[model samples]
Target: MLSMLRLTVITLLLAPQLAGAESLVSSLSDEAIEITSSFTGSRIVVFGVVRDEQETLDEAEYEIAIVVQGPESEIVARRKDRIFGLWINAASQPFFKVPSYYVVHMSENFSLVASEELVAQYKLGLANLNFVRSAYSPEARGFADAVIDIRRRENLFAERPAAVAFLAPNVFRTTFFLPAIVPVGTYRVSVFLFRQEKLLAAKTENLDIAKTGLSDNIARFARAQGALYGIMTVGLALFIGWFAGVIFRRS
Candidate 1:
């Protein structure tokens, strides 16, 4: 009887943790990225909510993190340099920066949440190039601009919730400002939810910058292309009909 009672007590104790793990749910409001220019730095904002299944737990604590990856070649070179500096060629050191993660606790009463992450600071000289002229002019004109640009880039920060709250469904939002000097390429935004150092949920979104424009003009161009094709089809039919009538009448 005592062994059976002990088993029952253990089952009850472990039930909540298992339920909590399954109950934790999160989602981003907007996962697609929109950028205006490839040469210029831009900002990305993420908004979403986290919800808990159990009503009994009125509050929960969590941590958030943003990870920025450097250019692949640079990252590989850096790793090699760190392992074997002497064997590697004496090239200029590549730049890499990582953001510190944020942690907060919240009660169940709160629902809306937000966070932002600026990625330009992770790379050197990315926040300094003028979005308009950098593509054409690769040289830095003067020292003052370089210094100011570098300073501006270093101050960038990732977005986070204004306040933390309980494990209830809530809206979260964040904004990121990218500088004009950032490279014209793809980037990533990651959101994480942690319960006292243990990661409970996570999401990642990809951001891309186009040299012509932030998002491809596919919708706009598709409509025009459709119309053009329709016109050509009609014109071809008419020509074939005319040629057939001409040949038949003559025969």
Candidate 2:
């Protein structure tokens, strides 16, 4: 009878921790790549969400990161610049790092990337900026292809409630980017999740880099404007008569 009573007490004690595990879930809601045009180099923003399944916790804590990889020979033409009277060298060569994870890697592909685990007990919350890296290569002047691996950290309770817990499942969102270049085609973006240094899940998506949309429109407009200016030399007039006419229309 005493053993059965102890068993019942233990079950009740472990109930909440187990319940907490069941309720804790994380995910990425907005997962995609954003492309923009620039004269010097390309820029892209990768955004997503880390949601908790159970509402019990005040907030779910996790980290988001990306593993970026691209062509190797493309990295060249490195330069140095002076900042605040100090000589600082900079590179057009591309590399990847996570500020929060404190992990850095350089590779032609996303194979050598690593994640910096956060200190146990603390949780990384929403709006947490994980990683950002930009590279400019001579070959990339025409086009370049790269991959991104997004990861999230999960928390799990340990046997001893006071003891540090283990990491649960890591959610991932991977994708690829291809800057404008010759012979565009569909590119594959792969994503994976790891738990305890082992991959647990994987997913892939395809990105098309065809010449259409705002980038093309803006390029066409710029060319047309430049040509018009060269041929006609038109300029905006600062005439009081025109200004008065515009104000009169609003009244």
Which has the greatest lDDT? Answer: 1
Clash totals for all models, in order?
25, 0
Off by over 4 Å in 2: 1-41, 50-183, 213-251
| Model 2 per-residue lDDT tens digits across residues 106-207 | 111222222333311111111122222132444432221221222222111001111111133222222222233312234332222222333323333443
**What is the alpha-carbon lDDT of model 1 when measured against the actual structure?**
0.37
Could you give candidate 1's per-residue lDDT for residues 103-220 as a string of tens digits?
A: 1212222113321112222221233223312323333223323433444455332222343322334444444555543444555555545444344554445544333453335434
Q: Give Cα distance to truth, residue 198, candidate 2, Å.
A: 1.9
lDDT of 2 at 57: 47
Q: What is the lDDT of candidate 2?
A: 0.29
Task: State every prediction's TM-score relative to the real structure.
Answer: 0.39, 0.25
Deviation from truth (RMSD, Å), model 1: 18.3
lDDT of every model, 2 decimals = 0.37, 0.29
In candidate 1, which residue ranges exceed 4 Å CA deviation? 1-19, 22-41, 56-58, 68-71, 75-91, 94-169, 213-251
